[model samples]
Target: MDIIKNIKEKGDNMIYILDTANINDIKKAMDIYPLSGVTTNPSIISKENRDFLDILKDIKGVIGKETMLHVQTLSTTCEGIVEEAHYIRDNVEGELYIKVPVIAEGIKAIKQLKKEGFKITATAVITANQALMAAVAGADFVAPYVNRIDNISGSGVNVVNDILNQFELYNLDTKVLAASFKNVQQIADVSNLGVDSITVPLELLDKSIEHPLTDWSVQQFTSDWKKTYKTDKIIIK
Candidate 1:
């Protein structure tokens, strides 16, 4: 179905998955050229030791123009969440996606945010039903914690599968963002399953570039190139 072409060319049914723990990391990820957006939670922001607005501004500056930047809301009440959503949207540039929990208050805020033309993501979700509810609430993204679910009982992949099936059946626009990835296998599995996108950590992104055969072939090519082309200096035109 030319999935990559459809994703990058048409921009239909495609999502950008980013792994960012801090502003600098988010900037680095965006600098990679293929990153579509950055995702963060309270825990990730807390580790930066910078004020929330300052960190957000830094991220926006790095990931400018049409990139999606998600900021998680900590408030439990719908009113509080809505207020935070407005604050984030007002203060941030480009598209600001508010990350809310999958609880009732979050659903309420999501509905209102959608009505107000604000992008929203329902995060910390672990079940297919939660994905369903988030879609029904008009969430732009539904983030399922794959590794965290596996860490507790090892049914994470199944949850993702169910959510994908449900999304297909309902023709929902809420993209399933497989998150909390622990290894390369999980990334490959989710990508193969056609989950909309997966938010991996920095370590896993590095691991994705590692393959024993690929490494060996690259080393062989470099050695052969050095042996064949002896000169290291370039001639002036």
Candidate 2:
């Protein structure tokens, strides 16, 4: 299967968030490869200063077809939320996943939307119980704000683990997507625990491939290459 299809097939296992804070940043991030999909919020969209449809179109263009592009709903009413979800699905050409908060209204919207065959993601979840509620509401993905939970107390990672454990116990299909990642350690921690997916910031995603030793090793390799090539040139082709 293609990369996008593979990523989506992994579902709860692999999730990459778009944290460019704008459309242009999204484009740059996708250029790096292995970008499964993007998660966007109202705050991130506000920085773009463009209509939601315009921004969605630009994101779909850069991410291409089969990429799961998540957009949060602004309305609190179930009807309004469904309306917005449908609007986004109709307007965007790629795989559009509607992000509903884990509030009561959002849960109502999620159940209704799921019945309508619309993909729904439960966002802003802070606890294991909230994640359970999202799953019971028929959410395709339950996102736990890891960093935010840690900020309040230092148990965000534990919360994510608890959710994962519960889901396995009940055999719920809803995937636990760890969100609000603050650093590479958080990603490593969650990934190590075997959580379904992690929606990380762009900077942290880039940092995941780097470490002090890796950077130093690369610098040393470059220096050695320069010195070796000074006397004679070696070309592959």
Candidate 3:
């Protein structure tokens, strides 16, 4: 029942997060799995065609106060980014982590937000150098897009690995929140490296814990038990 203790015993305490803003998907994922947070981007938000603040509040209502909600800033300027960060904090309930990109203005905004005592998560990072810059800027978390990196002739998992090594070498406080995964294997491989967390789509979330052989074995056990007991249900006094 102690999840943290079990994760420590397994030698990996990787946090799981759902990477979509769909309220139904978030509710379903949390109902079926142990999730630490939910992450969103401009692209994900654009899909809903709904009011941004209402969607955020609805997501918070589903995930509750215990889970972290990550919302990205759409601004490309430091001032605009800061404004959006403040608006999100003022409107959204519970703990919020504002996601800023690793671009020029974004870095400046991150530095400013950090100085102002905000929970900053640097996102859309394609290279290890970008992640390093986010760390140097004092971000609470850095997200490396795994599948997107591979699409551009680079290894996404490798980028995450390199960042982890750099964070360890320099003793940075930033945690890598790997994102943009197309398959379950990408998450499994990165979890082995002991990355801090990963945000995956709902479709691939349950796949990591399922196997066809396991289902077959369970069916066989049920059949054998029914034959011996003459009933599928357990009898109790």
Candidate 4:
């Protein structure tokens, strides 16, 4: 119990993570929302064009140590993945969730990392079996590519549901971290079924939170308030 205490995840509500490496956007989101953390892959980080330490450290500075930072491994071999994990662990100061693809080699690395008490997020998951195998390998989280599955004409939401059901059936503690959202609808669909964690691109997250009716209603309230009171702010009589 003590060995895996820090890495094990159990929560009643979903956790939200920003799937971006844009430092300015991350800082803005952290200031505005109750964001849980940030997630980055090689593709995302490559866009930043900064050294790994500099990019990650800048994110850490904005989000702070309490928030989780999920960084994916570029290696495809178990040995390489383990070495990369160690490198990141030695440099980063926080609860870093190592994102590994749900492949043969990645599963092996996850098992080794789990034993060493590293927080593992098995990413690139498209099937229930892959998620099941990763969970069996003791992954703290399994990230199923929601939109990517749908793009291939598969029901991403159904896959996510199946993954959640399997975890419950097996009595495993691995959380489902749904990823690759193309739209807010995908996020909402996954949210309805029960996602332990979701890393949303800012555009989709913005869509998820905003509505024209919401804005109009707030505008109406402010207009009505002005008619009754001289001050725009709410206060006691």
lDDT of 4 by residue, 38-91 (tens): 999999999989798889989999999989999999999999999999999899
Q: Which stretches of candidate 4 lie over 4 Å from their true place?
A: 1-11, 235-237
User: Could you estimate the TM-score for every candidate?
Assistant: 0.89, 0.88, 0.93, 0.92
Clash pairs, candidate 2, are: 12-196, 12-197, 13-196
Per-residue lDDT of candidate 2, residues 142-197 (tens digit): 88988898899767788887887777778788887788988888888777777777
Find the 10 residues in a row with the least total lDDT in model 1. 1-10
The superposed Cα distance between candidate 4 and the true structure at residue 192, in angstroms, equals 0.8
Top model number, TM-score: 3
lDDT for each residue of candidate 1 in 1-237, tens digit (9 for 90 to 100):
222212222554445567675765666666664777888899988888978988888877888857788889999999999999888888877878899999998999889989999888899998889989998998988999999999998667788888877877787777888899878888777776677877776667767887899989977777777787764333524
lDDT per model, in order? 0.80, 0.81, 0.90, 0.89
Comparing 3 and 4 on lDDT, the stronger one: 3
Ranking of models by lDDT: 3, 4, 2, 1
- Mark the regions of model 1 whose C-alpha exceeds 4 Å error after superposition: 1-14, 232-237
Candidates sorted on TM-score, descending: 3, 4, 1, 2
State how far residue 166 of model 2 sits from its true place (Å): 0.7
Give the C-alpha miss distance for residue 119 in model 2, angstroms.
0.6
Q: After superposition, how far is residue 146 of candidate 3 from its true place, in Å?
A: 0.5
Whichever of 1 and 4 has more TM-score, that candidate is 4
